[model samples]
Target chain A: MTFLSGLTPYFIAVFCVLVVGFWIQLQREKKPEEPTGETVSTSKARRWVDQDLQDDTEIPAKNDEDDDDDDHGSELDLPHVPYAPPRYPVASMLERSQDFYSLMNQRRSVRFISPEPVPREVIDNVIRTAGTAPSGAHTEPWTFVVVSDPDTKHEIRTIVEDEEEVNYRQRMGNKWVKDLARIRTTWVKEYLDVAPYLLLIFKQTYGIASGGKRKTHYYNEISVSVSCGILLAALQNVGLVTVTSTPLNCGPRLRVLLQRPANEKLLMLLPVGYPSHDATVPDLKRKPVEDIMVHI
Target chain B: MTFLSGLTPYFIAVFCVLVVGFWIQLQREKKPEEPTGETVSTSKARRWVDQDLQDDTEIPAKNDEDDDDDDHGSELDLPHVPYAPPRYPVASMLERSQDFYSLMNQRRSVRFISPEPVPREVIDNVIRTAGTAPSGAHTEPWTFVVVSDPDTKHEIRTIVEDEEEVNYRQRMGNKWVKDLARIRTTWVKEYLDVAPYLLLIFKQTYGIASGGKRKTHYYNEISVSVSCGILLAALQNVGLVTVTSTPLNCGPRLRVLLQRPANEKLLMLLPVGYPSHDATVPDLKRKPVEDIMVHI
Candidate 1:
């Protein structure tokens, strides 16, 4: 009894600690359900994703104004003006819609690009058209880097080929070996060199505002991508052929090679020129309009 | 000394427990650095973002084939065919580029839409044009919901307005009051009721394949956005107008209202029609060619 009494305080101390430890463990388990400061792996499926395209790169802006469609940007402060764009007659509108659909429908991602030099001014006009896309808060968050130089194109090709080879081999397992028969080309991008122009589309993750402080470009990826859609339409309008290639993990290397600012990450790379006379594409049918559209 | 000796074992037990507790605490501290499988708040910009649009909603696809631009889906197994699309001469190509640019550049987001009915067929052709956009691995991961019924449009408008009002009042504290002067429209969206058609674009994050298993739609959001870019160009081509509004936190409600599948998440909402006679847009100037393009 004396021995027990002598040891009683130490035993109580141990008991108290065990209770506290278990309580802490319960609290710790509850914490997993809440948001932590740790960032998400937006590139998790594999290294095959263009890791640069994730929105996590854009740090959370201090201002609440960044995410919404404030549209006008700094120019958002600009005055309102009466906007009366051309409104065609119903018949003419129908004709125009059908004509445009016919033209756009003919567009296919062609891998074999002709070596013929495209008119520089034509490329300029297409980029200009793309720039006209509406961005979040009028912050035009796209930079089109047109690479026409042969040596630079070769370097770009080399960088892409190296990473793509790694991606193709490493990303694919035994199934990839079986699917190799189904794979189009095994990472050899001849069009990168052969095409007259390599239009590298970069989305500015953030922009420097007039105060020279960083401004958040909200929906920057979507904005730049929408702009690319218009750019594709422009290219198709001029009968140019190029494949939309979002090179996996090659954004950093390409950004450096193109001497673009750190904020600009490559969203897409298009090799612009005519299709080779012998160019071939996989005969693919798009989902019919009914399959894609639901009348509610 | 005898009492102290009596307490020795208990003391040893207490000391050992504290050391273990310290080790456990150290482990607990380290855990927050790694992912706890908790979802990311992709909509953290505010409740203003469409939470449904986050990539985290899609389960981690078991197949390694999910993320890359394999271009051909199940159809990827199809044979490549010779492709000779129209080849325009240099002069014609230049002319076409200028023509298309002039048309697309005239496009703007006009908010005050005319109530006059637009032809349904024109909308169909425009959607068909949008459907022609290339997708990652040929998973045409887009659903366009066209609402022409006045009642459904009103319901949508009600849902959007309630959320937008909450969004406007709650999100902006004192600064939003100041920025409201610059804001074009308040939470009241008359165009939702006034427009001839409301097009809600959805991105299928996953698809039910032939095996009755889910397939990941890689780059689905980007794919849908690109398709929208084409949709916008198509609208512009037909002399129609729309204001691209991504309603903050209104996606799930709208999704349920539209009866879209679980895999479909709202990416964009456009109120489509002709601009009202008195419609006015912010007198906005796009970035010039040199500003957006880098000739390397």
Candidate 2:
């Protein structure tokens, strides 16, 4: 009886220690360490596929933790400037609206592309425009890889085509095949090499904090997708053309090929350039406005 | 042995019949009956919730299967007009680009809202602008429900508050709570009622073909998200401010409340209105261009 009573106190003590230990572990997990920023290299950009020495500098890490308020750190902070929109009469607004609609309506998915070199500044502007897309909690979780090297384009095309062959023959069912028939796209992807640039869009599934702690990213797919949409529009604004090509089962290979960090996943591959003279799109009609829209 | 031999012929006959039946079924599923067009109602647009009767005319049915070419059916078909962009000098392009950048940079996520009524035509124009957003296979898989009814808004607000309470109290982890603390948001969402209009964006997961056949929607999430990006830009162009509010666990109830078809799922809830007399956003800074963008 004496021994039993003594053992009870010891057991309770052990339980208390375990509970405290668990609580501490949970707290540690809940708070990730602040990320340390990386120094960006100003070296001339080179295609990782073509050259053995690629720019190994990591993108500057962002601290998403402390951004609960509107105030950001004052280091290199750009002052918020006042903004005033130009007033337009109803007629002008209508005219502008019609013009925009007409212009956007002309955008078509092009496959037969010319290997015309696009200026770096134009591509940069398109990407910068894409960055304005809204995201969940303002976590802009996207990476744009612009590839203009002919050798790199060949490599990407080969990898994509290999997987696409399997997808077309085996992975995709009859319905998917039938749905794609009107587009007349086969397993072959000749435009990947023909296009002057391949804009590979990657979505960061999670953020890597200091000490390699993972931060959760919300709406990663949606955020990247929205950015891609804006990128398309921006390209259109510059009179450039692109086709959205999602290469299924090519992410792992692509990540390794591009030497991307482990946290990123390939979302969509857009081949950007001018359309070939003989380029023709399937005469696909868009759904009527009444079919797609409803007002209440 | 004699009985087995006699049954072999019967088995073969049954197999042949089954094959023929399957082929016939597949054929029937491929081509849907041409949709009978509906006359759009031009009656005075009224708040559907306020009146016992509502505009019941169905949106024109789109023939997704028949779009083998660029031409649509002639019946009530909006003729395609030729597009020719006015050539702007390089200086003008640069000016326009800078102006667009400055204007878009000014866009902030506003929470403090005003109850002043916005014009119906303005709301309609925003919705039409959203319609111009491109979709996968041009399916145009989106439905925007504009809610201005005070009673409906109140109901939506109540429902959202209930879910947000649960999310804040229990569903969210400590990290999530801490992350949102900077934004100073809570279970209370009075803006749902305070905003003059609530644009409920719904994504069509799949198309319900005529006679109940299920048609696949490619890149559904990405397509709808892109449409939403354009919608936000379009709203901005019209000088209207909106905040993106994603109400979790409110989809099923919203579907029932809005009387939407089964194929649609709520994607985003946007409260549209003028900023209150004293509207303020968090001074949070966006990640620098080097952090968010890359060119190689």
Candidate 3:
């Protein structure tokens, strides 16, 4: 039987990912040069995303806060406004919930990836979606580095495997390694090189003000974690697959390799691309809802 | 003019929140008994949600991973198969991106909340959605405490405000307090009582094995942060509003109040509800994208 007839449901998913990947390549070929001095192949993908945000016309009116309700009034010397959001009927609400939940449920942690090209705009949209995550004190303590260069990926792979080899060979105890056996993961990481994009997420412990002053970031880990979660959702929502690969504090080397400022620390290294035709995940189980939640 | 004619867009928002509040009250009034011995109002909320998950027939076949592909084979002992996701055309993909982006963009931090009760099912669904977020080594590492108790909320509020009073009057430096001026926030937080639910998210620092052995959780902060972020999105996606209030290390008091185990620590205390008819957010500004992202 053909691929479609053999796994009808599964092929539908694969076909979608392939079509998007194909579409992205077509868009890239149409316009070889981006205005920001980026070649279509690997333009600083982030610069284009920044460009989208810069070009946004939806800036909330500055003086809108003046319309604040007198009942719950503010004494601050700035404008405020009454806030109201559209409400949907119970049916629409339930429909949306199911739609989003079902979409999210299909997402899985993928390991085997193909060295296929992804459109820059897709990555840009994912990061932009991630940036929407709320931060502590609005510190927004996260920076995304998109690496499409083979040389950089190779270097990253080398260092990460070095750490993993040590981890598998000595650092991790019997229990840890044994637990990973179901997933059948080893120190070898071919996906690091095979995947076309390596998105490095960094968390800024503090911010540098205009005068070079140090501004502390509150709940940095929390803020970055939330953003990264959204990042994964964004990627999955668009049909891309990734594994949250943490190289056990490859931060020192990564910071130097990427030339990141000292304040920024490595949070997650995501190798993003299409799952190889032969990609597979270990059959793992999630704890049931009754086990994880307590209603009081 | 009536509320509707006076501020067309603003009142439309108010009417919606009010209608939802009214609907929830009606729902609670209709059913006054729940299996968990909870008052009909709160009990139906979570039970219905739990029922949804329990009734889900879409659990993937456990042995699907056994269908391994031999084409690009893995040496490990396992089965793998080709993964193909359905593809949408460019227009549809772009539309989805924009649709999700605008929805997220409209999400704001709400403070003034109506005591209008929210369905427990909604909260359960939101939490379940949040749980879908990937975590470090798949440890999950988060617990959600859904507190609808009035007495508990009152007690928690008193301590939090006590701490906040000190933070505003003595603890915070000038710049910090001054920065908050635009938001018009004070030590007094009446919303803690005004909102119907308090979702206190606790992060598990480590897991206690059956034999009382300590199992260290890797990247706990990162994992919990991502989960919390998804929690916020889940809430907003379902027409609810909340504030990510960090009671700066209220862990000690909360741990006591909630009677949580020692291993679990407070991460965030989110008060969830519909915005008060008079709710208003400060006209805050996010840093331009150019400032936050770098292309490498």
Candidate 4:
């Protein structure tokens, strides 16, 4: 009886310590799950083959590690300079619009790129025209890798073709219950090896400002894509042909093969040259302006 | 003793039911937190003014529901047709390339738009030119809503300015701890009211095919952005000036106001017209060709 009474305080102290420890442990486990609790039930569906194009660099929480923003940021408090772009008379403007539309409307994605070598200076000029496109905050966040080397092009073909086959095989396991022969043809990218110039476009996910700190290139993807549109226009004006392709799962390998820095990512790959004599395009019709534009 | 023994079976049965219920509850709670656990740590940072620009239509789990995709899917078989864009002589190609580059280099994001009424037909042709841009799987997922109605333009300005202020306030709470006075001037979007035409660009995240089933538009956002690039080029070709602005937090409100369907999210907004007489621009320089391009 005497020993039991003496040990009561010690037993109570141990009990209190155990309770405090458990409460702290419970708290530590509960923090992360709280903010994300409401998010689960809403994300019912998953992504298909479009996994490579998701660039969310601003978002560290990611998928396939391809998160990057569009190309640019503008300078703060830069001196404003007097500017006036040439204003065309209504008649000239009308004439120019019709002419530009006629030229662009004739442009099509041609896969049969001729092996004939193109002028490097002309290619440079096309890229220079592309660089003139506007970017987020004026951040010109694009890199044009003009690959003319035969061995390098072949290596790119190997990497891209391998990944493409894997993508087809993965799709085959899941939802793609189609004719395997027809689908297999899509996996073989012969143009990668045949083209005179392989234009591999990349977007700088972020930029290095002074002191080596990371500067955000907001809207980098859109800015780069827009630049690509101008490049296409320039190509059409100069009578060149190329097809736009986003190689499935080939970004990382191609990035490594090209020895590009981590800050850059593959956006589009264009095999550029004159079209083959037997060049062909998919028989598709574009929706007219009435179908695409709404006026108020 | 007999009565107590008789109640033991019932008590055991009740205990078993309680244990099973708790096990099921634990399982339900435990899931959903698993697939998303590694993701929480990386997403510590958040998007700022760029939040409105995050058009992730594919990711249904979203902020303000502006999330979408760059799009389209292809049919099993589309017939091919012979295609050969006009081929120019080398001298003509060089001259064309140089002329195009010179023209594109003059293009800038002009903010001060004159209120003079431009011809509607020119705008139509520009939109038509934009529609000609290549999209993911040929999905031309773009909508250019041209607002000339003074009332609607004013209403748009109000919505946009209000949201811009809110965005500013939200940034005020966060890391935008510099030059509030200078930044305040940017939020006052007078051009929205003064421009003859306001072009609102939307990327159709998914398309409605037969039977109202959603058809996936692969790379819809990128595709639409590319189209906008072409539209910009077209505008430049016609000597029209405009400023591209992504209204912060004004997407949903503007989407509802513009009566764009649920599948369409705003990608860009351009107030198009001639430059105001006292027009000025930031004296900015783009990276030279050597810096932006690499040869392998």
Tell me the DockQ of each model, to 2 decimals. Answer: 0.23, 0.09, 0.14, 0.22
Stretches of model 3 off by over 4 angstroms after superposition: A1-78, B1-85
Please report how far candidate 1 places residue A295 from its true position, in Å: 0.3
RMSD of each: 26.4, 20.8, 23.8, 25.5
lDDT of 2 by residue, A117-201 (tens): 6666677767777787777667788888888878888999999999877666555544454566445567899999898889998
Q: Residue by residue across B23-85, what tens digits does model 1's lDDT show?
A: 744664688533222222323211221221233323344542443333323433345556778
lDDT per residue for candidate 2 within B110-206, as digits (tens), equals: 7777787776666666666667666665667888898988999999898888877765655554445556554556789889989999999888866
Which 10 residues in a row give candidate 1 chain A its minimum summed lDDT?
Answer: A44-53
Residues A16-113 of candidate 4: C-alpha lDDT, one tens digit per residue: 54565467446636784542342233121121112212446434333322222111212233445556788899999999999999999999988888
Per-model TM-score, in order, reads 0.77, 0.71, 0.71, 0.76
Sort by lDDT, best first.
1, 4, 3, 2
TM-score of 4: 0.76
- How well is each residue in B64-132 modelled by candidate 4, as lDDT tens digits? 222222121234334455676788999899999999999999998888889999999999999999999
Worst 10 residues of 1 chain B by lDDT: B44-53
- From the highest TM-score down, the ranking of the candidates is 1, 4, 3, 2
Best of the candidates, TM-score: 1
Q: Pairing residues by index, what is the TM-score of model 2?
A: 0.71
On lDDT, who's better, 3 or 4?
A: 4
Best by lDDT: 1
Docking quality tier of model 1? acceptable
